[model samples]
Target: MNPEIIGQYLPLYGEAAILTVELGFLGVLFSAVVGLFCAAVLYLRVPILRQIVWIYIELSRNTPLLIQLFFIYYGLPKVGIRTTPAVCGVAGLTFLGGSYMAEAFRSGLEAVPKIQEESALSLGMTKAQAIRLVILPQAFSVSVPALVANVIFLLKETSVFSAVSLMDLMFTAKNLIGLYYDTTEALFLLVVFYLIILLPVGVLGTVLEKRVRYAGFGS
Candidate 1:
């Protein structure tokens, strides 16, 4: 509605968007590592570690990112464990996203027939070699859709980074509204920036999913 106002605040939103992307990217990257490790533990059915992974997955999935951020940013300080807001944002996102990604990867791993592993082992491949060479590729293909969804979900979850005092897009928008009382303009820019950030990811995910399906990964 207000082109001039929108233009004026564009730089602020841009800066916030950059921070959002940086933090989201880190969170998702670390979450994938965590998820893969946990999924591997579960898949291998490692003795005590399997139970621990399950507990972690349930706890992370059950809790809200907001609460996790609060605990990290506020509660941790009580125990003398201080962390910057950016760190808190990334940590919370990783904790939350890892669980979802673990499930995605676990489902993908399970979807692969047991015979594939057996065949790989029969061919004199060690267990690790069989998993790395034969199983992971196919499982990852099956996981593309879910992994894309989790990536998008984790990126959107960055919206709550403001709760940790990060000057992310949501924070910028709220700050603008508070300062200028430009509710419509602020919200409009918020939606526009969010769309700018998320739309391409959604499109890319769709494209990737289709390719994976065509390659005979998932239904």
Candidate 2:
């Protein structure tokens, strides 16, 4: 717990934290889109696409992010498809997060009563309009908690970005410890940085969940 050492490496950790956040944000954004699409396919029972989405969801959910990153960053190179570590990190996160998010969204969709859809349609709304305007809003509200949880989980998974040499927060801490043997200080900083990243998210999620529940959208 050397003050001087902590001071010296704080900037490095800050930079790494930004990179981790950037990668995590991108991953979560893309994964949400992928998840929504997959959930829609499954919800609508879209024939061939549903089966493909199911297989993808199973494969992604079953595999580890570490292995996925390894494949994207290392294995892809051998196949003549190269990507930067940052790209690999984002891609891996999206691939893994998508499945979890899909399940969350699908559950949300299913929780909405069938009568709701029927009512929307009986109002002369097109099927797509009913889904887009009526169903999705309620489903999303019901999904707020799970989606927030998935976001936090995916952000934490960014820790493994170091496996691909991405120089993320974990990588910075490990590098500092290896170079200076300041294990205690480095670990302290690591925990602090992670808190800095995740604590606000946790609090925000709670706030959103309460709001959703208060609005009568959550059970």
Please give, for residues 186-209, the per-residue lDDT of candidate 1 as tens digits. 999899998998999999999987
Work out the TM-score per prediction: 0.96, 0.96
Model 1 segments more than 4 A misplaced: 214-219
Clashing pairs in 1: none
Whole-model lDDT for model 1 versus the true structure? 0.92
C-alpha lDDT of residue 151 in model 2? 94
Q: lDDT of each structure?
A: 0.92, 0.93
Model 1 collision count: 0
RMSD after CA superposition, every candidate: 1.7, 1.6
Off by over 4 Å in 2: 214-219
